[model samples]
Target: MTRPDPADLHPWIAGYLTPYTGRTRQNATQYLRRWETWCGQRGTSIEDATRTDIEAWRAHLSARGVRARGIGAALSPVRGLYLWAAQSYLITHDPAHLVRMPRRPTRSQRPWLDRHQLRRLLDYVDHAGDPAMRAAVHLWSLCGLRPAEPRQLLISDLGTYEGRMSIGLSYRKAGGADRLTVSPPVEAAIRAAVAGRGRGPVLYNENTGTALSKAIARLRLIRILDAARVPHVTPYGLRAGFITLSLEAGVPERDVMYAAGHSSSAQTAYYDRMRHTIRARAVHELTDWLDLTGTPGVTPMSDVPATLPP
Candidate 1:
């Protein structure tokens, strides 16, 4: 089948994406604009874009100092756009689909805070200068929430059962919505943070009580880590610490998966990999079953004859 004209794209795409295009569409548009600029600079029409052109663009991004992962992120939208255009018959050939995405480098395992470090960090936050900042740290460290989750939390999200506290979290993950149940310590910190406030987000600026931005979360977390003299700690590190601590404390993987609202088995595996305690335990169990050390009266490897006795 012949490809449709590139000029026919705008209207069809805009309508096709209407229902799905809130934050994702906005980001996709920005990426598409960049792709357009690159094509224009090369004196190529959008319809004339080819797999080679996409590959060149990936190389160009890398040459301009973009990281492999960043290149992958930027190209993701372009890939989607071409696929969508193909599906709508706006393009006969999906050049972006033919193009190989840049390989993402393996990220090092994030360093999780030990129990002592977590305690120290929490203690510092408990006495920090700004009440909101203190509360933010408490929520992340104690409750194991992603940085943005706390800022999105509402008053009605909190629940109590038999005097024990818990939080109901509605969070966005893996292109979908998932919910989490917060632990008691996390609930207590949240309650303390918003004792007087009636509604809206739980963690906010002390001066305005407005939602916190990702940048603000990073800055505050960095400050807290620095004050506690904990190295290599990010907001995500706190989450990893929580998973690690939970597994160490004998929490089942299934329970952790439910509590964290993980949507996929792969995500659960990633969490397990991050928790060294689980990895260690797994190795120990395997080694015990393997019986690497020979039993009594059994010849060790060194004691065995070099050649089999006839």
Candidate 2:
């Protein structure tokens, strides 16, 4: 079916997406427009959309081989719309209020460098990498930044938070910003990259005074890894390296979760390869309350007077 103009169907889309940032707003607009096209086909206005109409639309998307995650992403805006409409007094009933997003399929643990391999990669970059590449690598590998983060960071994002060196990032997976404490290596790399400049891209060319393109950053990393004789994984692997290695080095998982900007422990665990390997049983914790001393002060369950107490 030909796509219809989203605005003709829903004039409120622009206002609804204002809270989202960057590509998020763009993607949400796209999702809602597709939904509007679907609504046009069924001759149902969004204001008059019923729960059954939403479910049928979900089924339609599913029939076309859209995965659960894609379906969920497409539907997210509709849920937001009803809430917005109800609060704005545009609709009395929320058709999407009870509609549940499809559960995402379980993700396999992603690739990451082990400590020794990562050290070698870092060493190579430090010795031969251009200033921009070195800083990007350190931010991703040491500070657990997303691939886009090191590329997009500004010099002003660096600051002192609670007496610790902090890197403030505005581009996060969930939206908003995060201020992560930096490791010494990350601090040194960032300082060197942004030296003598008050406010500009953190990863910029010395001669050009312009930010390094994503291609340049990625290409350099691949070459550096190859020269260092390390397994070549995508830039995301560098962040996974940070999380996996941090947990292995005895940094608490909860702390890693916060630093990595994960919404839940499960998201952090998905990036982990070391910690979940079972060294001890969780069932062992059940025995923590056990008094195995056989002291007479603790009555045996067989001799308990439960009936009398009642």
Candidate 3:
């Protein structure tokens, strides 16, 4: 039998999810559909699903060996729907509010590659002749970009600010434009990857001529790590190392946060153990090791502004 239309059951879901953007909106849509399916299978309507009903569903999922993270992922959207409905005055009482997620198991801190290991990865990509791969390595391994950050970039995002190449980015989470002044190697690699395309993802597959996927990128990185005898690390590990190493090297906490795309100091503070990590130099001090090939943060050309220092 086909599932019933969710709009027929409740008309508020669309309005409730309207504020979410990108992958967040997609995931919410999927989770709500699953909730609707579960309600239909149990002969209950979403409008009438009580806290008890949600608890029962959680119990059922747990019985089937679903992990806490998986269960939480399924429940959050449903809970959000109820909260929205109540706030909008569409529902007099909110259900699913009291249903708590099962506690997740704690995992150890993620490991990261040192500068030497990262250099090896960079060297590997340099010889690979895939401009997209080269740009990806530079952004993530050197610039400390989260995996999603570079994946969402468009070719148009790369441009010159004050005679130096820079990337203009709008954060998906924070929703602000963060323009990063790049070093010579970063500028060169990004331009080569863009390859005169007016628009498209920054990380593209030359072989397939499509946007490079995060999974494929991770798989490629893992292969390099294995060959180089480096420990496996997630994209977050690369970011962690960037933050940790920069802080240890005495790059000011403020500059470190700015470079890492962190909106607040609290976010940057979580990466290191020290309360204070300021030193004599600015951001360029930390990035100078990259061999910027010009005075750090100095404009090669005249007549433009630096949005944020390198």
Top-lDDT structure, candidate number:
2
TM-score of 2: 0.72
lDDT of 1 by residue, 185-295 (tens): 556567777877888777757665587767887887787788878775777777767766776777787776665556664565564534555567789888679775556
TM-scores of the models, in the order given: 0.81, 0.72, 0.73
User: What's the distance in Å from true for residue 92, model 1?
Assistant: 2.1
Compared to the true structure, candidate 1 yields what TM-score?
Answer: 0.81
Return whichever of 1 and 2 wins on lDDT: 2
lDDT of 3 by residue, 127-215 (tens): 77768768877887567787788878887787788899878777645555788888788878898888888888988877677889878
Higher-ranked by TM-score: 2 or 3: 3
Tens digits of per-residue lDDT for model 2, 1-310: 2333545546777667767767677677788888777888999877688999899999999999998878999999888988898888888888899999999845434578998998888888887847788898898888888888887898888889778788888778856788888878877788878877999899997666688878878888888888999998778888888888898888899999988888899988878876545334334554445744465586778888768753
lDDT of 1: 0.69
Candidate 2 backbone collisions, by pair: none
Give lDDT: candidate 3, residue 210.
82
Say which prediction, candidate 1 or candidate 3, comes out ahead on lDDT.
Answer: 3
The models' CA-based lDDT, in order, is: 0.69, 0.81, 0.76
> Least accurate stretch of 10 residues (summed lDDT) in model 3?
273-282
Sort the predicted structures by lDDT, highest score first: 2, 3, 1
